[model samples]
Target: MMAAQVPGFYMKNESRRVKIPFIDSNSLVIIPVSVNGSEPINFLFDTGVKSNIFFSKTIADELGMQYTRKLNLVGADGQTVLSASVSPNNHFDLGEIEGIYQAALVLDEDFLELEKVIGIPIYGVVGHEFFKSNPVKIDYDNAEVTIYRSSALKWKPFGFRSMPMELIGNKPYVNTTIRQIEGPEIPAKLLIDTGANHGLLLNRETTDEIVLPPLTLETDLGRSLGGDLFGLVGRVRRVEMQGLKFRGVITSYPDQTEFSDVIIETGRQGSIGAELLNRIKIIFDYPRERVLLKKGAKFSEQFDYDMSGLMIRVLSAENKRFYVSQVRENSPASLQGVQLYDEIVAINKVPAYFWELADITNLFRSEEGRVITLEILRGTGTEEEAPEKLRISFVLKKQL
Candidate 1:
């Protein structure tokens, strides 16, 4: 579907650029946005999607927004379709900038469950609508997004590499090369997906040259609106674009059966997500059909995977309580008796509440052979019976 013809304007006519701060949670960008004069709400700023999507129908209803039509929304897995109502002619206020007569899709059900997964209240996602009319620069180190007016801004190439991008179906795709552990360099067309948290994703069905590495770990890649996406995690020898290279990059290979049915853009092989993008400062110049990139502060940091093998979720609205949502079999966490639904009370004697979800995730990805201690409360606590509290310690190990 085409993106809505929503034009965004600055609050002040003389303003040429506006900086909007964002929260980098799990490598995903979250920004505060107010819709139709409502209070500021947390929204995911995603380049992977074309439309603004509201997961809560109640929020739209409370704002007294009118639905103009019904739309069928497809999940990332391609098979699951959900019903949605399109609310047209809505106003959006993104701090210093505002868009009038914007279109938004309100889903009938809260299928993503992003709040539990990200440990933050993410109401929806805003994508092409906000990016189509401007040159948006993402400063990863500063945690801010600078939106420049296409008409007023002058392009400069100072220390930045410019790469041509293809605008297809309201999404941006770029060409690059990937070197697998055992093969020659393979040409690839990857989507610039800021919404995805992983470093890279390769669809093995895309080409014969794109093969899984010799070593791979079977794991749950992530959740799509359809359901849990199972995949393999491995490392590529190198991935290079425009003379910039990243070595030993972690890559995800979603099962072909899970994504094959989905109609992808022509010649699209995979996607470059935020985990890798976070290592560089990026400018999405959609108006000119190009992307500008420069090295970021953490450019030289090595890519790491989760060594704990525990998928955690926030069980409280405040994002303080943590629980083990999934435990990979035969991994360190599972081997150490970390089971699903185990409420993590403390880590290394430090209260789990004192740690943010990002901090915990980073700790698990810190390094292999690192020792971790956890005190967890398992089972339900009844009036007469109390839940069992146990301490489990494990050494992190690299599975792949």
Candidate 2:
């Protein structure tokens, strides 16, 4: 109701509003896409979203879109939370329809490094507003969406496709049946985050339970929005979804963007990432409180990095100093008493700023007790003086 009062954006401004069967808050679907030639992989429909966004690197490279400039982003309270990788504006053609669009590359140790993205998977994000101009449905039953192109027709969920799902606690769980990707027999029950980039995410428990497949290929830095860190990069034989499956190389990590600690204890199942959601035509029946899961026609596995939160930026400036940038609320860094804007100069007598991603990872690689110290720069003017160097110890136990 409140959203209706304000002027809409792009498609919303000229949207055809028609209420279709909607799930809780996901009454509408938004899918902002860049038509890349005639590839079936171009158009996308997405629901769960706070905003519409896209990283400029892969999409720009694919279509030769010029991305210029850099932008900084602040949290809701206006603190510089992170920096954005910017590119020259570009235009998007959605099927026969076309529209000009702008994009921001998320650069922080968490989102990705523009030039170093792995596999160059998903191009950008589409919000529910994208559907405002067109009424679309995800039929979990048929694993496809029936589109109405015209809002004049009463919108209805056409295909109803529901994959067999298990719930962990209060979250939906999906079974992972990939070979050699063995973890505990207790399958993972994920939240079915339609908003997540990677179609699936492995929890620490699953990560610990499964023996890591040997690295067929290793990237210098495993990526995430969390900044360039070490992750085992390679492929797995196959991961299945309700008997439907695809074979592809996948990157495995120990962190989840949201619900980092959400666990599937006794009776809980694993989670579902966008990788699975985007593949099928499905509806999140929030109104009826069900996710009408379905399969998509275009089911080819494209290379995509399962990451979040940081941008990997190479320092070209000499005498460059790295600040804390910003810390995640109650994160390990914050819990250790690290402050924002503090300069991390070195670690336990080891220089940190110029160190490669591998260096930091090496220090934390030990499967036993590991502790490192930091020499930080804090304050300005009178605060310009260095704070007493503090040493913090952290355990690198198998992340569960």
Candidate 3:
């Protein structure tokens, strides 16, 4: 994407810095944005995407937005392509900052189904456009984003480590090293993706050194623009970024069969997502092509994966209702008789309404062999008969 063609935002007034509070949902940042002066709607703050995109066309239709053209959006897997309409000259109000005559892509259908995945209403994604004209600081500890004017900002290194960044296709990329269990450190060029939720993603086909671990688990990685992405989950010995070293990092390797047709950039290994990024404070200086990082509250925390082997989805965020969307075969949840579509009514004797989605996920990824009780509502909701209510307990164990 060309710099001139990229959509950009401008500061509304003489403010040198603008602070925007965000909601951190499962390692993803959700911010409130108003379109064409409409009420604030939740939008994902992503660095991996080139242009702003609306997951559904409903919002655009409601705002009486007109389509200037149609675009074909390809998924990361490279096979799934969806058509989207481009609404040009739209006004975007991000509190203190505003974008006039901005372009946004609106999908005909909500292909990602992000609400069910993230347990919130995610109408769209705001990407490169937000960072093009300013330096953005992401404070994971405080759940806030601060945008600073390039001219008014002062450089204060302090304890922060500065590393060079490559701005390619309107996205940020950084260089890092990965060490396998029995091999030399492999240098990798990874995209700094704030949109992805996983810790580390490595494309095995990128190089001979980037191979899968001995033990791996076949799992549903996440949803893409196309559909659900299936992949293998494993662990690498360590990942080194500059002088910072992270040991036993949880890694993801997407199935090659699905990515066979995908075209990756030269020397681009994979991406580093929010899972690892949440452990540090980051300042993205796009103008200078450098990123400053400092250790955060979770810097020393060990990396972990979901030990319960159950993928839970939010049925209703307001009602605090959740259900098992997928259960891994031969896993703890399956072994304990946790069936698919089983509504989670309570956990550890507490009502589901009392627990947040993040709280439940944190418990699932807690210590191994940790036993937890679940109050499940089973059976179809049809009028044939009342749903069966049962109690099941399961021990969470590491799969990969």
Candidate 1 lDDT tens digits, 162-275: 899998878999999998997778999999999888899998887788888998988888875656778899999999988899999999998876456443436798999998
Give the runs in model 3 whose Cα sits over 4 Å from its true position: 1-7, 152-156, 257-263
lDDT of 2 at 57: 48
Question: What TM-score, to 2 decimals, does candidate 2 have?
Answer: 0.39
Residue 190, model 1: lDDT of 93
- List, residue by residue over 1-400, the lDDT tens digit for candidate 3: 2433445777777578888899998778899889988999899999988889888797789987789888887765676788999988788898887777788899988888888788888999988988877889899999999888767445746888888999988899999989987656789999999989999998777677877789889899988677677889999998888788888889998866455434254458888999999999898899888888999999899998899989988899878899999899999989989999999999999999998888888999998989989999999868988899999999999887
| Candidate 2, position 49, lDDT | 34
TM-score, one value per model: 0.95, 0.39, 0.94
The global C-alpha lDDT for each of the candidates, from Candidate 1 onward, is: 0.85, 0.43, 0.86
What TM-score should be assigned to candidate 1? 0.95
Model 1 stretches astray by more than 4 angstroms: 1-6, 9-11, 152-154, 258-265
Candidate 2: list runs displaced more than 4 Å: 1-3, 6-160, 163-184, 191-199, 205-207, 214-216, 220-226, 234-238, 246-251, 254-279, 298-400
